[model samples]
Target chain A: MKKLFQIALGIIAAIGGFVDIGELVFDTQAGADFRFQLLWAVPVGVLGIVVFAEMTGRVAAVSGRPVFDVVRMRMGLNVGLITLAASLLINLITLAAEVGGAAIVLQLLFDLNVSTLILLSVVCLVLVVYFVPFGGIERIFGYLGCALLVYVAAAVHLKPNWHEVGQGFVPHLPSSALYAYFVIGVIGAALVPYEVYFYSSGAIEDRWGTADLNLNRANAALGFGLGGILSIALIVVAGEVFFDPHIQPGYLGTTALGAQQAFGEAGLVLALVGMLFAVGGAAVECAFSGAYTLAQFAGWEWGKYRRPRDASRFTMAWLIFFALAFVIVETGVDPVLLTEYAVILSVVALPLTYLPLLLIARDRTFMGDHANGILGNVLGWLYFVIILGVSLAAIPLMLITNGGSV
Target chain B: MEDKQMDLVYRVLDDQLVDIEGRRCGRVDDLEFDGSLGDPPRLYAILSGSGTWHRRLPRPLRKLGERIFGTGVSGRDVIRVPWEQVEEISSVIRLKAKARDLGLGQGDERDAALVAKLPKS
Candidate 1:
């Protein structure tokens, strides 16, 4: 019973930590643009995240090292610096968006102004990070985030052709310029770089070990896999309700309203609640990720398991980022546009961080008997190439389409 | 060493330093080399500062560093060590002496007065 309880908690935390603001925006955008055509990317992304997360978790548990530390050791600082700078920019943009999205959730619910909503969101996140136990942070987000299942319920209620949905399962090309953006959106939503950073680092903070390797695998598969299902549900909801409405999803309000369109009052309430939790959870993770990456790379004390002053540098890094990101929102920028850009930049930053992780996890010296097998190596390299391709084209396509409006 | 290789030092030089107790201090931002280049070149000091670091960076980065930290901050001087003092290398650095007791806090003054740094044999 005790063992079962532990696994349940693990699963819950994984679920809560899995989805973020990117998934919320991109899933809805894909649905609005190409209906279920881009849905296949979610599963593809889930598999990719699962494989990488497993390797990263194993590396952390077996080698007692975080991914950033291993990156410096195996790939050297030049490459590591490039990845850090890229990931840092991507994370900063994401922090702004999540903060903004969470505020919007409050605004919709209470009819509050954007500034008041943002301030409350910031304070709420700080208190969560400051006071909540790390274990609770994971589980609360996972379970409360189940509020997102509203999208699933909404999809079921709409009564789409399940056969047609299964047919869209086979990957197909997007037909137009906007089609590329939809594909990018799905990719961006699915294979976010920060997810791996938070997951592996969290495993280290939790002190996972060789004994827990299976637990790590199960968490990655189930957590990310379930997040993938939720993502597709959002896509289905958007496709069923908004595809005929001919609305392109460039804003958060459209997504919120899209859910309301699917299930009326109940749908709006679920979307609002889910958005609050998902965006709130994501903001906390991204802030900590800045601290984790820097401290892991430089070999400083880190993690929420440690008190703030105990990991002074680590705490400082996140606090500084949180302050800067909130300042960006305060400058009155549109958070939705900011998120679109963040997704694009994260696409660019993905390969640098992921490639070294693949290389090092396969290294016998670090991982000992737990090093990657031949199959792991192939998947690692294949994903490396795909991430690079997506990154290289992400910006140019955004420009060509003028932010996907053309 | 090529001057450019010296510049590459700032970027390439960062490795986590741990004391004998395996507690992290910081990165080895700069290396203090014994300039008495009579034999095969000896690395005498491990420097850790922007001024010292700038001397080992690309020209652009060096100038940028200089612009930010000033030339004095990019000074060649660092915590020089007699290469023999370094005990071992592993996941963490294990120095023979505690960092504070060595008057490493006092900088070059104590290192100059007490210990004559010998080149590696």
Candidate 2:
């Protein structure tokens, strides 16, 4: 019973930590634009995250090397450097977007100035990271982030057509460029590289070994599976409340209004609170992921398990990233718009991130018996191809759609 | 036979380097070998630092990376861990000396000194 409870908590934390500013923005916008038509992309992307996360998580647990370390070892110095540069840039932008999004949510809830709140958010996140133990940060944010379940409740309460909702699961060729853009957006948002970097590194920090392989699978499957359900709920709620072509949700506040339409003032407050913790959690992950990648690649000692004083460069990297993120967001860019670009641009980094993990996970020398099984190999390569295609289309689609505005 | 058996590029180069106390020091950024061209070169040392790794890049990026990171160590831009110090090479390259004794992680130490001056906890 105790073991089951611990596993349940792990899965719940995973689920809570899954959705970030990118998923919230893209899922909500995709739903408002195409209703249930884009729903197929959520599960597709969720399954992709599960497959890759499970593989990479296993690699971390078995070998004690995280994603970036594998990138350097397998991809070599030149290609590894390029990948590191690309991922770090994307991580920075995503970090800024999450921090900005969290500030916006705080502004909505407390009616405070966004600039001031942005500073506050970064400070609090730094403090949380400094003072909170690794598991504490995960559980605190994860448990509170479950507040996003209000979207699931709102989706059902709005009472959409069940038949149409079911049909959304069946894939269809998007008839227009806008539809195609959202398709890429939803997938890209879900498959952001930071999640893998953070998760694999977290596995190492938690001291996962061969014994934790099943636990890794459970966390990836159930945690991400439930998070995908919340993403679908976001789309469903937006589809019902803002189905009109004119009612596009451009702001984080407008997205929360979907819940307001269902449960009024109380619902709005809950949605805002959920957004606070979820987006804040994402901001924390982004900062840590960036630090992890840098420290891991440079072969510096890193892990929140160590005191900040103990892991000096690693500590400095995250602190500097948070400061940089604050500067980027303070330029008055719309957090939602910044995240849209971050999501789309992130697709370009997806292939580079997943390819090394796929190669290393299948190697018997590295993984021993825990190497990718037949099923794992097939799914891993299949998603690699899909991610490659999505990356190829990502930039051109962004250009043609003007960041998916059309 | 040992040289033929172990794929240095696969197993040694770029693997994490852990000191005797099990603290992570750096990576095997480059390797040094002893012997003339016609003779069979034997592994001599494990080279680590931004300088050594950046040298593997194309010249243009190499210059830029050097400019950004500045070679390494005491103007050499890398620290050398003699092949003799290697305790084992498995998932990580475990060394038999302390990181300080190996001259690895000088940058980390320097930066750590600066970080120590800040208010922590």
Candidate 3:
């Protein structure tokens, strides 16, 4: 049971981050416009994430340094500072979005005003974070996020075509403008850069030495791969219920409702629980990643394990950033807007964050005898080009498609 | 000569620095060169802290750092170590300079800058 529980961590972090606001919207949007045509992107993204995440994990385990620590050391202070600021901005924006997401969920459940719920959500997150010990934070957030597996169960209940679904294993793009837009949405979901930062930093915090190298590989390959599966299930459920009816996946209510078509009332409850965990985990991650980037850059003592007094600067940076996100969400800004914007920016920031890991992972000087083997180097370079391509494509697609609106 | 201990600059260049009794000081930020007659040019002092970091920077970065760090301006940002004083380096370090003796007691120099800023309740 302990071994099983330990293995659950990767799935949990992936679910919390992937099934969170950005993904719930991205998958649903693709389901409505393109149906199973975009399903291929899900596994494609799974492969992409698995490649880079494993590299990041291996490098961290071998080097005894987290992602940002290496970035600052190898890339020099100036480039590190620029990337740090960019990553922090993405984290803060995602934090605001998660706060807004939780508020929207409350609005659905209690019939309360979203503004009031936003404030309440902010307070709740802050309190949860305040008493949360460093070691326990990841576990709690990850486990709770696993409740998102309900969407998978619901998709199975819908009895999606086994034959057609298998076809997605091969890449095939639809010629329609709407389907092309959906492909972009899928890429956005699969390659979000924050996942890289959070996962690699987590590896460092746990101090997984070279002995833990296989553990790192297992975590990345299984954990993120499972999250990608959950994402595809969400898309299937949306395709079954909302596709023919012209319903779009824009709000929290609609996403839960789509699952209801398959699993009935119980599905709704599980879906909501999943949403709760997803947002909760994402919130904790973004807020902490914000702090991690800054502390690592300035070479301050930082981590959740350390006391508030010991890591004062790290603690204060996150506390202030969390407060700022709370304030932003407290305004009437839509969580959906925040989520979509965050995902796009996260994709755009992809190459910047991953390139350093790719370079460091393959660098013989840094990794010594433990450097990425031929297979890792090939996969790493493939994802490097893919990430660069997507980052360049993001802004133009956002403008040309007007944020994927057909 | 290999049997004898090396100077802090010669040995600890790009190495982490610790206090006299052994605590983290930071890193070797810059080295002071004092080459005089008849001595194999020994390092006179070692620099640590943002002050030494500033000296190593291009002019623009130095200005930006000065602006952010409140322009105390000069070598005070660093703690210079004379070679005779360094102890040893390992996982942790032992230094010849005490926490207080290395200008730390004046403003508590050896500790982290953020810790120094904290007010006692």
Candidate 4:
């Protein structure tokens, strides 16, 4: 049971990184627009993240260092600094969107003032980070974020055509620029760089040595695989509920309406509560990820296990991130729109983020007996090539498709 | 010294620096050597902190880093731990003493003190 609970780290990383406010709506939008045609991207993304996260987690456990440390040591200062700068930029934008996302969720729940709820949510988040232990934070958010599984129930309740749902799993050539954009967006959203940063750091925070290799694998495969399942359920729900060509699942409330259609008020309540924790978890993930990258690069003491005074700069960095995110959201930018831009920027940063991990994980001098075996190498290099290709196409698609508008 | 067997750039440079107590201090941002032109340059000391590492940046970014992070040390702006103090050369460079005793981790200590002043931190 204790070992099973260890998967919470993966759950939080996956649910928070892959199914956050931005992704929840983004997946729904894909379903509403392209229906099941984009379903293939979810599993493709799930497999990609699992492969990299397993390698990254193993690297951390065996080497006694995090991903950024390898990045700096192998890539050297020039390349390392470039990675750091790009990561921090995308991290800040994503953090801001999450803050706005959580605030919007709270306003939906209580009918309170959006700005006031924003401040209130930030204060609560600060206090939670300060007071809660790392494991406690994971359990609270990781388990509650499962409230989003209400979408699975809703999808089943709607009883979509089983044949059509299965067919969605098969990839199709893009019929239009907009279809291509959603395909990449679905895959890229699942492979967001912050997920690995948060995942690998969380492994260290949990103190897993080589003895915990099996645990790391379980966490990576099951936790993220569960997230992929939720992504599919969400798309199925949106496709079934919002089938009309005139309708668009553009807002969080509209996304929740799918659940409402399935089970009425109780389903709606569950979806909102689920979103509240999932998006809230993403806010925490981004803040910690930003701080972890900086601290690891600079070689400062870091980890939530340390007192605030112990990892001083790390503590300060997360605090400043929350404050800056609050300021960004207070500008009244739409959280969903901000999330779209953040996802695109994250895809652009993906190759830079994963390259060092791949290099070190495969290096015999570093990983020794645990270096990438045949399967890991084949998958890692294959995904690396795909990421490079998608990364090159990401910006151009966003411009041509005008952020996935049909 | 039998330095020919070791690849300093790949094995040592930019690796993590940890003190005896297993606390991370910084990275080997730069290195110093001692010898004349014809003599094989022997590794002399390990340079750490923003003060020395910033030099690796392009001239413009170096100046920008200096402006933003400041030279990490006062006066010469270099914190050098003699090569003799490195206890091990594995994934990390383990040191023979505490970071504070070696004039390292000053920023961490200073920031920690400031954080101590905050309420409920």
Q: Against the true structure, whose lDDT is highest?
A: 2
TM-score of every candidate's chain A:
0.96, 0.99, 0.94, 0.97
Model 3 lDDT tens row, B24-103? 34455556778778878766766655554544446878878666643433346566666566676542235787655765
Clash pairs of candidate 4?
A: none
* lDDT scores of the candidates, listed in order: 0.74, 0.90, 0.72, 0.85
Q: What share of the true interface contacts does each candidate keep?
A: 0.12, 0.71, 0.02, 0.77
Worst 10-residue lDDT window for candidate 1 chain A reads A306-315
Residue B39 miss distance in model 1 (angstroms): 3.9
The full ranking of all candidates by lDDT, starting with the best, is 2, 4, 1, 3
Q: Which 10-residue window of candidate 4 chain A scores lowest in summed lDDT?
A: A9-18
Q: Report the lDDT tens digits of candidate 3 across residue range A1-406.
A: 7656666665566555566677788888787776677888888778998998888888878865567766665555456657877888888888998888887777777888777887788777766766766557766777777777888888888888878767755677558555665676687767766677777778877878888887787788877877888888878888878888998777767998876787788878778777876887788778888887776655455666655555666667777878899888877677787877888888788777788788878877558888989999898888788778778877777777777775
Superposition error at A230 for model 1 (Å): 0.8
Model 1 complex DockQ against the native: 0.12
Worst 10 residues of 2 chain A by lDDT: A244-253
Instruction: Tell me how candidate 1 scores on lDDT.
Output: 0.74
Q: Cα deviation in Å at residue A295, candidate 2?
A: 0.5
Judge the docking of candidate 3 as incorrect, acceptable, medium or high.
incorrect
Stronger candidate by lDDT (1 vs 2): 2
lDDT of 4 by residue, A217-255 (tens): 887887787788889988899888886654786776788
Worst 10 residues of 3 chain B by lDDT: B103-112
Tell me candidate 2's fraction of native contacts, as a decimal between 0 and 1: 0.71
